[model samples]
Target: MPKYIMILLSIWLIVIDRCSGVSSPIKPFTLYKNSTELKNDTADLWWTINDAWKEITFELHIKSADWIIGLGISSAGGMKGVDIVVGWVESSSKVYLQYAVPSTNTTYHGKIYKAPTGYSIKRHAIAHKMLIDPKNVNLVHHLKLYECDPMTTLNDDQLPDGLCDEIVDEIKFCSLNFATVWAVGGDAMREFPEEAGCGIGGDYEIKYYMIQMHYDNSRLDSSTASIPSALTVPPRMEQFAIDSYCPSEVTRNIPKSGNNVIFALPHTHLQRISVWTKIIRNNAAMQYLFNSEKYDFNYQYENRLLKSIKLYPGDSCATRCIYNTKNKDKITSGCERTRDEMCLHMFTYYPRMNNFYACITVNDDSAGVLWIQLR
Candidate 1:
């Protein structure tokens, strides 16, 4: 009799669980800058996103309907992480501001979330910072911001819960230029030099920057930006090294005008002791684009070069990473996971190239790829 009673109670609980509801706030309007609606044919407005990181502006003129008007921008629909500016006229004009922002988001499952670019016109970003929830840092392996063509119309606002890559069409990209690549141990802030800037938005032909956040049961997983499989590090070896080469054939995509490198971020997991990039021209050495005498996984930073290095046509670059795996009893291979390993050199340069997105590569076979001796 007790067993029968328990079965009835279990069925009742299942019904209650199925009846519970989760509601997300309504989708907000898309502000594509060129959008101007003369509300009932009486208003004229022109607004757009600013050059600074995350800001927007508006100017509206209306014949009537004067009580409250707003240009609201928020991460959530209702109130959480809101940055809204409202105004009205009666006596000396009044403005109401509600500003609160929490830069990170948490999740219970694996997913990809995207945020709007705010601006659809040419704007230059001078600096950017990584914003990860301190408690959930372990969940993030990498973050990338992709530049897409100017979006005249975005279907819906990806707020509260971001645009799920699984449910939607895989977001398309128009340019090879990635705005940023932040990995596991990267520094919080990265600033560009005074003379140059990364170009985006309309006119620049690359607008609508989308921040792509990758969170799985563990780390970042992007089939497009796949890191080369790691090299084998034998147990009890004094030192192990991995190299990645961007063959000159691949570098032909670089603009004929050439590139001036301003900053570099060299990344690897815990075993790495040092990392550097060697540039080559005419099959001969040119310079070390960037180098680290000692690397700290805990203090990973994107370094701004004091004096920029130049990369012309017919130039190629290769990355080398040295590891200390002498204490381990097992072999390690290059991989994307936090527990595995990687060898990557990400650099920032401008007169931003539209045709060439990356010389991106990894040299797995030492026999096939070799760098010229250093000058």
Candidate 2:
């Protein structure tokens, strides 16, 4: 077991539409001619697919009504961070929907947020551009749009503009896979190439997406382009480094045609002095994928290669971030707050790979500090 645990209890859930009357205590529902049912001691679920509309409708019968029920699809493994939706009909009889990433959160006055909020894809579609929310104006410093696992079914409720702090259990899922990244003074949007895109309807469609925004109403440093004053950077060490990587085993999902990447963004908080990502093949350095010489926390944008880098089934990728922390004495590890630290590399690739959604592994990570049930 990990160091800490936070479990969300699931209570009884029932559903009966206003148009339909309740069933008698001794009587049970009869399965429709074309529908199927699954039942247990407390709940029964009936569902059927509408091929014509490409939709599936579900009805649930919970033995009790103490709590609402949430249902969605996911990978065979337990749902820690895989993109899935959770829905519940509140006691007010109002339907409530939310992204299944974590519990709904809120923002504070002086803190910077890196909230990964979810958005659902109604059908098969291709993403062409990712732009900063103009409404947010100078508040959003950096943003990353990540594609949830295609096989998952996640929800998207317009939760309040919230602060997204570090949730230990979500580190793996949230940091590994990113589809688009937009930073301060970046292009109008993160655009894709004409020849290829992430995915669209059918087998390649993404089910859900989460946009992690750094919400800090800080002005840009006009001269040095150094760390902004709004972000808290405590000096604790002379120098420190963080690393993130994708192993060769994860390359199995790469197709024979290869995966092509055009642009990459190596991200960090305020202290990084240098950053780089290297592609390794056959246990040797194949190419220096991206190396930011004099890293600047401000003025961050994507570094596009002259040509696309293609990777086959056996290739792997690694990234490193070096920080100068000589000023004060403080402890900081990987975290979501801009005041803390994060080392991540987000790149846009062509010909999406299904199972190869995420390959990042956090260095020196223990089991976890928190556990929030999403089943």
Candidate 3:
């Protein structure tokens, strides 16, 4: 996690609109809708974090499984390190509601990398260019780059430059802006009540808040989703959410293995009605940690065990998700998109195993390939 250390920092509360530069009253709650596609099936995503809005309710009057809806707090417009509560109605009529947050480490080309904070990335990139550009006198003075190295170069007066690069490197965006807090999901329609501790930093309190909604209609032709924040603030927790599977793009059968399972949530699209995570030893004896026989798509929740189960490194762990296919209709399966069925068990284990909390068994191919034989 400590791949890079970002040093100098200051808090910046975004009280005014980014575009309009006009200030609005800090309210107890806010609601947002996608104005671009207003006629779609999604509902307005709402959230609150004020004195009176301890218990925020989220209601979706969805008509079909044509959309994916979720919301949470974040420091910026992006999803990294955000605390999100997302849900979707699978084509199989199963509904799933989950609380999820993206890790700071992003996966790309089968590699993990850390991205800088959005503000820092944007601000420094501009500062870097202006420092090198001799013509940007206004920018140099505005950023106080002139204070670093005001002496003109002996070669060319116009070619001379302030220590803009050095000044930019000396300052950094606020570290507190990333604070966030959220819960996954429950049978209740409303979000769990939470206190408003957006930090008590007098005037410099971080103000940027972000909420995003994603709707998936890949199975069909289309979809839409919403929320907004003037200031960016991160959650206050630092814990890892890990999953045990194969390496990225690598597909391997679940060999006998064992580990303590603290929380388990079986994930599969609508084609599944039942899913199970069992610990198998010697390829014979089996112990179940999670099982959903009559699984409903709308009420998927993280089934946390009262105690962590013991698993052996040599013990094989298997996941079985059953889907209903009348045979009279068409069958869909793939690695990406909802039309294709998936079999994955999202688990949070105790006693950290490796730096990589989540493992991918199959890259981006049809896990449904295995489903074919199981069916």
Q: Which predicted model would earn the best lDDT?
A: 1
Tell me how many clashing residue pairs each candidate has: 2, 9, 27
After the best TM-score superposition of candidate 3, give how far the Cα of residue 147 lies from its true spot, in angstroms: 39
Model 2 steric clash pairs: 84-154, 85-153, 85-154, 85-155, 124-201, 235-328, 236-328, 237-325, 237-326
TM-score of each: 0.59, 0.53, 0.35
Candidate 2 has a TM-score of 0.53
What digit string (tens of lDDT, one per residue) describes model 1 on residues 255-288? 7878888888888877889999999999988889
- CA RMSD of all predictions: 14.5, 16.0, 23.8
Residue lDDT tens for model 3, 1-375: 112221111111133122211122232243532111112433322223233744334333444463565555444545454556666676778887653422311111111111223442222111111111233221111111111111212222222221222323221221111121111222212121121111222332232222111123233332221111111112231221222323222212222353456666666654556777676666664687777776655455656576667655445556666665543143343333344445666654433332313333433243221211110
lDDT of 2 by residue, 1-375 (tens): 212222222211122222223342434354432322233355455555455975445555554433555665433435543344455544455665543423222222111122222433323223445554476545666666665444443234422233343332332243346666776656664445556655534433544555666555334221212222212344676666666566777776678899888887777867788888899999998888788878787767787677899988888887887887775476554555454566766676777554665554532235332211111
Residue 334, candidate 1: Cα error in Å is: 2.2
Say which prediction, candidate 2 or candidate 3, comes out ahead on lDDT.
Answer: 2
lDDT of 1: 0.58
Off by over 4 Å in 2: 1-136, 154-177, 201-204, 217-238, 363-375
lDDT of 2: 0.54
Provide the lowest-lDDT 10-residue window in model 1.
1-10
